[model samples]
Target chain A: MNEQPVIRTQGLTRYFGAKPAVYDLNLEVPRGCVFAFLGRNGSGKTTTIRMLLGLLQPTRGEGSILGHDIRSLPPEARARIGYLTEEHQLYDWMRVKECGGFQSQFYPRWNEKIFRGVIGHFNLKPTARVKDLSRGERAGLCLGLTLAPEPELLVLDDPAMGLDPVAHRSLMESMVYLTRRSDRTIFFSSHQLADVERVADYIAILDRSVLRMCCSLETFRNSVQQVRLRFPGPPPPLPDIPGLLQAFRAEGELRLTCVHYGATTEKALRALAPAQMEMVPLSLEDAFISYLGERGEKSFILSETEAQP
Target chain B: MSFNITISTGLNMPIYKQITDQVWLAFVTGKLAVGDQLPTVRTLAEDLVVNPNTVARAYADLMRDGLIESRAGRGVFITRKRKVFTREEGWRRLEPLIDAAIGEAMTMDFTHQELREAFEKKLGQWKHVKGGN
Candidate 1:
């Protein structure tokens, strides 16, 4: 088995003239793993993907995809990796079959059977004009073309964007199916936490032009929590609790979001003598929101819970 | 149906642990018996829409715990050798949980006697419903 990472970057930075779009990004995507890249709007996800694909050059640092330098990714190197953009860009003029034919010519190893199989799998008409297809169908068609090339590395920039729930689920199912192939590596960025939860083994969350968290999905979930602590009166200013991501104060209650909540954190809270304390596990989206949100008046409303001594 | 295994997409529990817990529960509840075959990792992953590696890890852990075994060229089969838990052991496991419940009830204006009577009544109902199964 090849041990080299499919994607790697070292201090990858990009600036759009005066504004820094991506800053000091160092990422490593292992071979054959489904990796999800998550960030809010304009968080440099697209800039990073564009840089990795060699379409946009970084102002500093360097990266590589499939052993080819990102600064100088060869056309052949680019061909080995499939890419699906947020829009699922395709020619509106070509018929479905003609679209497949046009894509096949560019890839020397393109399998016509697989192309036809994917088209048939999605139940897309071979003769329908791209302009006539619904937005979801166009996304499916784009996915089909991306996969038909049999690329070893597949990079998707928010494939679930603009797709309905069913369409999103179908797209994710296709991604899950593709990961069965031993040599295929999929890196997708999306706002759909539910879809990401379904398919991603590893995840990277970006914030403010910098990579925030990158680890296995299990690790990310295991390490964060939403804790509720009730006091006699107003809660005091929280002590410097380790892994305290954010804390919100309300009437007689302090709601805390902590990363890596464990024995030590528990001990610290016990010292405070709260009437009651409960560590609740957050859903993936809740965790993501808490991680991104600041420590001001929290939007996480405290659910009513009376406390006993 | 072999095992109605479902993974909750919550941070409360890891997916692998959920898979392991669901399988173990199925066995202890007699829903899964000895020699029952489990689905392939790929199938379960697809069904749950999770990573195959996560499913594989769960299966591997179950094998390590000796609750399941893999037969070459066949598939994973339940081993059914886990130790039997007495009622006391089971209740011991739930002691802290009941404490937490009572704690909350106290906060909600229920007296200790009232809460105890309610719990005992519920236990009686469970005994009648379960029929010593």
Candidate 2:
């Protein structure tokens, strides 16, 4: 319920040599919320996460995590944060329990109870060697180590990748438990939109090295709507609706996609008074694609029918 | 009581509907009850890191469905008992999806017996689970 942001970035930008990887990224993640970082592959999600963790320096801009300047904070600040990369690399020679013991030494807030719970919940053998574990088991072990630290903020990059359904469920359950008990803030990136949709309170979509949209999951759902209309002859010219994000014309039908389409857009569409009009609800994937398509190309507008004389 | 909402990405279901359905299920099952305040639109949005509009849509749908109501000052609340689905209604709702899933399972080399056994096992597990009635 705290109003202050746990993570905030202002005009953040990062580049891979001459190429801009992330541009003008301005974001604020509230405390104690599960923030889902969403994007296609190579959309600067990993880069952004690296910047926030201070593992990579931003070419420009500034930010803070837990109110401490990200760039200036010492390892102590990061120690208070738990991170799990998409590729969980643990010492191959150590036992799962040994890994936990070694990792616990670095964090002052390590929670043995939570650690044991996660290990048991994942059905991970304490004596299993990291090298001998399956990919899913290793990932679970990484997650177990991360959760055991009990950091104030947990940043995960695709924790569910390569996990079977049961392991995935356990990971999610562990996340829910951690968030509920500690009010820890979780920021995770995933190509798996369903998992993002499952547990995230906030979602940010990135595409082509730019942030396409960022909002609460609820707002994202309500603002976008799919409208289908059929007009006599070729479709009628669409009006300039303030929130129209994309429009397309096909087979004498006009399809309009809009963001923040409420009573206002409905009124505008009614003014055209097409022969047939229907508002179809759009799924999050459809909406994300629509928005990303529009953002990718400035000329990309929703198809509308040609104007009648 | 605490409740968690999960959306499945592997399935073809929409995230908003997943949110809506799961939250509805939570309310109906008594895991979340009348007067239980759900997270604010922005809080949940940030948690999921999705557009606030998406979460808003689910909340709006829930409001329209009468499962949860928005109090002017307090926030959204679970307002009613869960609706019990009749066998016909349940079949009506699930048959098509189940058919599709089974079809896919068949293509993946699952025999009918295997699929039925898996489902029976899942149902038995659900029956034993606490707090999901």
Candidate 3:
């Protein structure tokens, strides 16, 4: 694998008027990993992606995509990237074949076979009007078109949003098919953690427009955990423990979430003399919420009764 | 030949871990007999809709642990290793979980005697469950 990062940013800052959308952010998306850009709603994920693609200007600092400066990206440089917007915005009147033909004109490396293969894999008809196709079929058509261009990098912005479960699976299967090439890099922003967990090898999570976490999915899952501790009686106040991401206490039962969790953290919790201490695994969603909770103001831990929902 | 392995890919447990655990369990229980060719990494990844590398990692780990081995140009297969080794590997992988569960039981105020008896009963109930597989 090439050592060069396909996307690199330093001190990347973007503000919407007086409010900061992304603060001095430094990010590196190396070549060939399915990188998931995650964040809560309005967390500047879209803002950073826009800046990277030169669609939005950053207030301060610099970014580079595919070794070209993001701000002054040459028109021709855009050809090397393909983007799938959340909404499939192809002309509704155009037939599937027309949509593919229109897009093929823009790319020098367009491959009809690859396009047809992906289209056929989705079982799409050449003459089907875009307007008449279901949302999933339209998305599949867009994907086939994107693959035809054979871009080195693919940026998808919540492409699965509003998709039904079967549609969601179809989209994911298409993405898996794409990864077989091994040289393609995918960067996308999404809130669907379950799907993210499946396909993303690397991830960067933004919380309140701040870069809260970045690492491989395996490393991320391994580092954070929920440890349920039991004391004979109501546990004492949690007392600002280091490495504690979030804490929930209700009578005799307590759950402590930890980040960069290791033996040292476990030992500290053990010293509190819990009758039993069991380390539990956190799903990607669980870890995401717990990490947000670590920010103090937005915690995932709730009172036993408030947690029913 | 088609192979089917079921895993709820991304709920709490890492998918790769789940993959390894399931494969290991199958091997120990003899459901995946010696010389059984496992699905190629790509096939399994496509089947599960997971990062191919994750499946490859699970297979790689099993190879490292001597549970499975891959032949060049021929797909991976379960090794004709001793069932005792798989049983030992089982303990290594599951001991922590067992310990934690028992710990949790104790903290919940179950007596040690009660915990021991419960584990015995549970083990008796589970011992032959996989024997059918």
Best prediction by lDDT? 1
RMSD (Å) of each candidate, 1 decimal: 5.8, 11.6, 5.6
List residue ranges in candidate 3 displaced over 4 A: A294-309, B1-3, B80-95, B104-133
The candidate that achieves the highest DockQ relative to the unseen native structure: 3
lDDT of 2 by residue, A250-290 (tens): 87678998766777788888887776676666766787777
In angstroms, the error of model 1 at A223 is 1.8
* lDDT value, candidate 2, whole model: 0.76
Ranking of all predicted structures according to TM-score, beginning with the best and ending with the worst:
3, 1, 2
- Residues B1-133, model 3: lDDT tens digits: 3335777854877888889988877776557777889989999999899889989989888888787989999999988554435667777878888787777675578998998898789788668544422
Candidate models: Cα lDDT each: 0.82, 0.76, 0.81
Specify the highest-TM-score model's number: 3
> What's the DockQ for every one of the candidates?
0.51, 0.10, 0.67
Ranking by DockQ: 3, 1, 2
**DockQ-best of 2 and 3:** 3
Fraction of native Cα contacts kept in each candidate? Answer: 0.62, 0.16, 0.80
Kindly state the fnat score of candidate 1. 0.62
Candidate 1 residue runs with Cα over 4 Å from true position: A230-237, A250-253, A296-309, B6-14, B61-66, B84-98, B110-133
Better of 1 and 2 by TM-score: 1
